[model samples]
Target chain A: MMVRMAATRDGYGDALLELGGNQRVVVLEADLGKSTKSLHFRKQFPQRTISCGIGEQNMFLVGAGLAASGYIPFASTFAIFTERGFEQMRNGIARPNLAVHVCGSHGGTHTGTDGSSAQSIEDLAIYRTLPNVTVLHPCDDVSTKILTKQLVHLNSPSYTRTARNKSPVLYDGREDEIEIGKGVIHRDGNDAAIIACGILVSEALQAAQELSLEGIEVTVIDMHTIKPLDEALVLDVAKKCGKIVTAEDHSIIGGLGGAVSEYLIENYPVPMKRIGVADRFGESGESEEMLNLLGLSAPFIAEAVRKLLNS
Target chain B: MSSIAELEEVARKCRVRIVDMVYNAQAGHPGGSLSEIDILVALYGTTLRVDPKNPSWEDRDRFILSKGHASPGMYAILAEHGFIQEHDLTSYRVLGGKCQGHVDAKWCPGVDFSAGSLGMGLSFGMGSALAARLDGSQRQAYVMLGDGEIQEGSVWEAAMAAVHHELGNLNVILDCNGIQNDDFCDEQMRMFDIPKKWEAFGWNVKIIDGHNMSEILEGLEFLKNSNQKPNILIARTVKGKGVSYMENNPSFHGAAPNDEQYALAMKELGVA
Candidate 1:
């Protein structure tokens, strides 16, 4: 076991560069190309890149227009700033079922020192509510690259959330194994299962490893696609493990934890603990400090699993 | 090409159809529809290079009704141009019907984009124009925006982007009908000196009488001949132009005329 760390934004930039070879693939940005890493695509194909000049709503509508005219447009902005264009994305892109890829970078508290204004703790929830929108939060660089490429072939609108901080790469470039609406079972254990997305997948894996030493075998699953969730896997895990612990780098209200809990409560009726940000906003801090302060670190997740087991 | 008189006759028929659909549906924006019908007739009859038999023709010029609340006008034009059957106009706003309350490209043929939310049509038009430019296609993109819809911040965003991209194939027709949903635009948001505002945004601006067939054709010709910059034709129009009682009346902005008013409107348009 060798470990490699890379920001999910890097994966997005690299994947965009590769996708830029296709003339139909255009990239639109809202004046945050450098931070969102869409500048890589701009550098490669300047003609194909559209700078929307700090207008997220216009960027969304423009992307919809391009999609309507037989072009696949990837519209990128800060995850928090995507709220400015939510209505445009809903009405223009999702409502029409256009093939536009909305990439929201710096998702969640992992955005670190940029503070609450930059962090998007509710982007997935907002996008999930829109009909015909595929909401995805890739776990690490590898998954992000895989999913970003997959978005090119998808004919419906999709939202992909990437993190600003570098997380441990969980895959070895075996992208063929990843599917959009399917969950990847990283570690299988019988005691309890931990389902997480975005940067929390690595945290959940670390928690599973730490809990394994104490004779508590916990299964860790990467539930990346929030909308069109992998129900069969979740139900199988719930029926097998009996207890479920969900973790994410977002709010506990309507993120991965909320989606998982809502599904299990209805279908399986299992006892579960959701580990995420409670109703409070995040502040500027180092990435590791923010994760620890927000109780999203591996220890916090393991503690949550232990509590669920004991109860 | 249709003569000015012939175009006016078509516009008159479309105006009749607009009032009829709105009145039958029991809910619709007839004022803007009536104001914009003549402009649509001018475009559909002469300017646009579209095949009604092949609504999705790849090389066809794209028309987006950005002021989407005026769907009755667009639907009438689509029906007249043979893109959609005339009987479909009777099902305006009916559940699971082709004629939706707003212009839905999915349900309506010859509609280039879906628009109801204001200020988005310009952006979509710019995008289509940019796409055509990239593909080296001769087709152009035309977007019809409401006078009040320009107040939306997103419209300016698209305007600026269109100029920045230097989208020469993009044409925006602003139906400056004076009134919005509640009151006169000047009384509501005070969108004064709109032509100068567009000129300042780096677009080639043209002011035209929207209801006059000759002025409408001249503006279209100017746009078609011009190159290097995006063009915007600010067509000054009377709200509910053909219908005498609803003319310049803000009350008819989103209200379908009652039976008495509908009959009077039909008589005024000579379709009674």
Candidate 2:
């Protein structure tokens, strides 16, 4: 696809403006005007954008009401507020199939410097557990933009997890196939398929490049869409490689690892090593420092894959 | 013909179904359901201009149970009015039953909005009222809320919006049974002078004995005639009403009446 380097929040802002170009779309935010990247749309469509001023639960319920009234609503807030509305999202929005898009900024450790609580590692799990909710955590800004637009068109309740800090652009319009529930293989190999999502896709690619030099042919797949996981591709890769490695910037339980493991166990089980944050809280530190401290770098993923392949 | 006497009989029958339905299923929120039975009887039987057979007939009045735990009262009235089979009442809370633990639109007929969670009903009600007005429909929207569930901040936001828009078609009925699941509404959270507070929020307020069918019916009629202001009827009622032992008791808030308790309550309600 024609991917471009834009800030994920900015992509969100642009996609919202594009969404608002349609008269049926309405925008809502909870006081984080600039952070959520909704300020641009708010300024352009003041009548359509309604700010709830940090009241997350009310924003959710009101969005649900508006949705029931036949308006496409994009309700944005920080991950904490988005997580706080788990019940409202489940009952008022998702359960009834209310066409409300829940845009949660700062989804994973990419939020950086903030502690584990703000990282919202459990958000994917929380949203995935709800029936009829489609969960999407894009790899970069461009994917975020495309997915946001696609979700608005889908007319279903969706969660788009975005990052706070900028990272190197991975897809510079070099790809063609980006479909929901379909993994994009950045590299080809028979040794193992290092499936990853969010910012961890970049890490898995770097690891694949390094492992290739050591005579270790590694395949990398970006499993961006978490729910409705690409089970077919995952099982195919698992069968081809005899081993697999999954990584994400989220918790091990209900994040990428859990999704991959649950898929494999049901269809094609293989030796797997999970490269992500363990069951622990995050701490405030520099972005690079936290990444290194948490052992989420390419070296760690490569090491885990190497160990799994050998074992 | 005294409207009060007629409504009293309806309320009595509502309580009978509530006790019987809950006891047969061995599960359901009997306390608040019984407490709100009179309000439902008064609204559906005497006040609200609704054709049960034609529930989604755009011009029919809308009623939402914001405190969804008390949906038994709603189901009893809906079934009695022939919206659904009255024989389906005994399957309350059972798997594959038309009546689940809470109001489910997919499972039951005439259930406008599915609600299992508390505090979301008012905002939905407000939205429906707004949509109706925007579409030039004359039907009014009524939402029944629990006293404790009013503590949810969304309810106030919805209240403020309803007032700001002057949704004359919206009527919020607060089931002031005083008891929540854990404690009495006043003890758990003080909602002193609820009608005055709603008035302060720019709503037309009416305080009445919730159990008194006459007051409920009168309040409903008065609300329908209003032009530019939404109505909030503050109905003070016993938490576990009708049953002698469960009356005013917090324990029955979500408890299903046992066989003996059901028999006694039904006998008192003149069921047998």
Best by TM-score: 1
After best superposition, candidate 1 residue A48: deviation in angstroms? 1.1
- lDDT of each candidate versus the true structure: 0.91, 0.81
- Candidate 1 residue-wise lDDT, A1-311, digit = tens: 67998999988998999999898999999999998899999998999999999999989988988898899999999999988988998889999999999999999999889888888899988899999999999988888888899999889999999998889998876677788999999999999999999899999999999999999999999998998899999999999999999999999999888889889888998999998998899999988898999999999999998999989
lDDT of 2 by residue, B69-132 (tens): 8878888888877888878997688889889899987788777778888888887887677656
Question: DockQ for all models, in order?
Answer: 0.86, 0.47
TM-score of chain B of each: 0.98, 0.95
TM-score of 1: 0.99
| Candidate 2 CAPRI classification by DockQ | acceptable
User: For each model in turn, which proportion of the native inter-chain contacts is also found?
Assistant: 0.85, 0.48
